[model samples]
Target: MQYLPIFTKLDNKPVLVVGGGDVALRKCRAFLKARASVTLVAPEFCSELLEHASNNEVILTQAYFDESHLDGKMLVIAATDNESVNNTVFELANKRNVFVNVVDDQPKCTFIFPSIVDRDPITIAISSAGTAPVLARRLREKLETLIPQHIGPLATLVGSFRDNVKARFKHFADRRQFWEGVFDSSVVSKVQVGDTQGATAQLHGMLDAKAEPEGEVYVVGAGPGDPELLTLKALQLMQQADVVVYDYLVSDEIMDLVRRDADLICVGKRLGNHSVKQEDTNQLLVNLARQGKKVCRIKGGDPFIYGRGGEEVQVLAQHDVRYQIVPGITAAAGCSAYAGIPLTHRDHAQAIQFVTGHCKKDGQELDWPSLAKPNQTLAIYMGVLKSPHIQAQLIKYGRDASTPVAIIENGTRKEQRVVRTHLGDLAQQIEQHHIVSPALLIIGEVAALHEQLAWFGSSAQISSFAQPLTDVA
Candidate 1:
């Protein structure tokens, strides 16, 4: 933000223009349009300046630039051809803390005029900080054509009933929802067709109608680690939500994009730490929506894939709560791509299994016989703590000990680290590197391609790993 944009009300305010030629006349016209009391101070006046003075549009003084001319003025503009006079006016204005502009001279000006699109009450100002005025003007021209003429009238019409609407709905959220409904309704169509009377009638009718408020839940996937991976619909729901219920897996960058005022509730759980229980989280979502509050239930990766999203949705459905499920890229796919390891490859493996090594309960085991089959890939999520058991079981089930394996820690993030080894050393590499949670284990021949095809996070990778084959062939 090189320059902060602001709209000033110069209605009847005193303004000084330190020039009487064509440039000064142009500056005076802009002030007059804003209903400012413009005074031009120049010894030699242009013909148009004389005409304006004769019509009392601008008061003209036959005098050179002086410090006294700035007294009692809200704004000043120095448009003279003399650089000395422009610099003098700039210094005097700054000394008095008054805003000033020098025509065609950005550095000397305290305030520069922006290219404007004026639709009366709706004015759009575009500025390039005086770096590229032509580009700014082109942007303004495009906006002027894209913005419909009916918007100003529509705003005025809605503004007229603002007080009445405020009195009708005491809560801000209720008022916002009501306005959103109005924009989606036929009232806007009537205004577009120039039927102001009909539009006003429809607005009044809507205000008179009484309806019970209902809430909706957005089960959004924040995606695997990267904020950019989140879907557009997920982002929209996050902004619109009155409350955000998130997990620890969601990145802080993604959390920053949520509505600033939205109430945040962290149900985030780690391997051994649980902030809020799952049952309590489900009940909380039900209770919030029952109060007519829009709730955003955000999780990492696809909600159905190891995210416990289906459980939350089931609770909402049991309570008759409305919800929309937004899917996200699961860790298996996101981590593999970021680590340069394909989950399944035609030459390496034809089958892929997404397995969870750390179960919710102990004494539970996966189908090791089928998992240890050849020409297959296994993406084991949350496998750090149970890596030794997993490795031992796979080898016991006839999976070769030399089968390639890769451990991706903090996948798809700036701090991502990929440790490549063999299936026999899966647990050894994890222990040696001190790999932590949120890491994915890619096992099978497809994992060997990580060293050859790996691209991202290479520079960020730790240097203590075993010798990495530099050449693929």
Candidate 2:
């Protein structure tokens, strides 16, 4: 390594900066953030530096740079534009064995600033040994998005319990196992959501054996076709799952994010083909949790919407199993945004309703009068099979036959298709486009906005309707 990485304890340590311009101010700010006592020697200083000195943030020595200014300083920085003065400071500091950095002069720097990703108590510093500063900054930017903000608080909470945990588990191996269990338990989830008190209480209970090891279910919504739309909490739980229970609605890209070693169980339902019965799936969740396994029941869009997450959760509750609900971006919100068709527009729709064309065996019939009311947008899920029936009933109940409509297939995915047509031609467009399952229907004036506001999906707006045919013996 060109440079050895080490974190310094610079709290209250005196640091010196030689110069008074913008460059000098930049160095001082970094020192201030580290809680270092800074002293600057300059003939003239900028207004911002003057204001900082007025607030007693830094001590300003109004004099030209000299060897005497380097006395008793832990670190020195030369930020002057004058080459001769910077060289002098570097030489003098080196003679006194003090760490010195000459701004913009790599060879003269004994210590260099590193790109930092600061999550408070957790700090990640990336340095290219002063060779690739831009690349290091880009790496820091990427880490900023991947690392959650609650990490610092979580670390602090764990630190506070270190003594207690050590006292409880005398053996090193036992203590390690205890902590591994904590990370794999609901404690981490509680901490991630900023419930520190609850986490601490749970931790104490575990160390005392008051709470035994048990199973949990994270009923998470995977969002509509796009993996990027998954919530942070959902991502965290997905990686921690021992078994992932998924459905056909969840995109293929999302299934790839689950724990590689986890067992995948598909209870996905499709048009006229159910992989597993709903009652059996609900019982499966209860049985898995009873066996002490962390179950991730991932569904497309919001689980509470059309995903039947409530029924599964109710079963878990009846069995006295613990679970967490992580809401995801529903199809209506995601598909409309990606297709650039607003579900509710002041100029077009005053109200929005979520409907499902497929219903339970004993489900009540839909109120066509209310559904066909004017100035409202309808987002229908799983409406492909009933497209013809929906069109006839809406027109029969007073909805205009000329009202615009759109059918979005594989909404929000790369191969997404949006078929725009009028209410009178809704069934015709579905057949003409050869639309498949997993499609959403948008009905109202706002559906016409696909031509104007559709920005995310490709301009083709319509996919090819042709499919290859196969010959059978």
Candidate 3:
């Protein structure tokens, strides 16, 4: 790392800025925000800076940069436009063993400014160590949206209760577990939803649990691609999960939403490759739960669809483990919605069916004729590679060749794309669109509705028939 990450307490400290231009003004403002006593030395001052100095808010030296400006300052900033003057300030500050930043000159400075996300007491600082300031700022922008606005006040609330929790629960592990329970309970969620009174009540209830029951397991669905698509129940389970066993398909954004201290284990199974065997995953869950740890089996999309949720639940039941399932926006539902394709409609599809293309070793044919019926929407999961066979089988079973089909790639992710085609040309269209895996194929008359409902794809315009669905609370 070119720069070490640290948070300096600048309150009541003396800081120096060796410029008077816009750049210097920014540094001065930052120092003042930290409640620092600032001194600015330059040949000229901007109107804003002059007004501040006139009001005795800042000390100003109306002269060119000099080494004497470094004396007794806790921090120094060289924000001048001249590279030579910035270098001089760096050298003087280094000689005096003071922390200094040369604005936009990373190599000459002892410290560099970070792209800061300030939530008062809960500040997050992102830096690329001066290698890529733009990248750092971009990352900061993303994090700013992910973190709730009320996290600052919520953090203060937790801080206030820390000592009491520590004293109430003497055992280190028990205390840690209590805080985990408090966070996972309605307390933090209420806080996020702007219910401080509800959060406080919930916190007190947790603190009052003298002998709480053992932690349980939560089988959670991470939803399609968007973290926002995660159900409130899923989010609640994640907040309390002591350990998370996640799959490869779960997006980084969703994983980031998990508690930072949770033990994350990647048991993700690639299409044909398994990092850890399913049996081992089951054993891991049982072991963790036995230790009274709240484990979360986080799967992409709905847990029960193609996911081994049934098997996991069976194992939990066999072992008499306490657990609950938190449903997610299944792939078919999420992909269809975002791709503007309705799975079912009275004027088109009267029924919707979800079917997996993959079969067991003892090859048995799926009910192709039933799925090929008219007025029925067929959502084929894990079927991209089997499109040709599926299409041929359905056609052989008397399905219409002119049935509309939509191939949704990356589902609801930022890079999501959809291609509309007829069943006769579904395979060719998928190839043309370069549709990757984690995709779904929707076939039926309802697929044509995408022409009118495709709102998520940038290239696909929304039709007049498209309207906002009712808000789901």
Model 1: lowest-lDDT 10 consecutive positions = 464-473
- Model 2, 1-473: lDDT tens digits are 86778899889999999999999999999999999999999999999999999999999999988899988999999999999999999999999999999998988999999899888788899999888889999999988877888888878888889999999989999999999988777777678777888888999899898976578899999999778898877887898899999998999999999999999999989878898999999999988887778999999999999889999999999999988999999999998887789999899999999999987779677888999999999999988988999999999999999999988888888777788888999998889788887789999999888888876533453342222111110
Backbone clashes, candidate 3:
0
Candidate 2 global Cα RMSD: 4.4
Regions of model 3 farther than 4 Å from truth: 1-213, 457-473
Considering every candidate listed, which one attains the maximal lDDT? 2
Cα misplacement distance, residue 73 of candidate 3 (Å) = 52
lDDT score, candidate 1, position 289: 88
* Model 1 regions lying over 4 Å from their true place: 1-206, 457-473
CA lDDT, every model vs. true structure = 0.86, 0.88, 0.83
> In candidate 2, which residue ranges exceed 4 Å CA deviation?
46-56, 104-107, 167-172, 290-292, 317-320, 456-473
Tell me how far the alpha carbon of residue 436 in candidate 1 is from the true structure, in angstroms, after superposition. Answer: 0.7
Candidate achieving the largest TM-score: 2
Model 2's alpha-carbon lDDT is 0.88
Q: Write down the TM-score for model 3.
A: 0.56
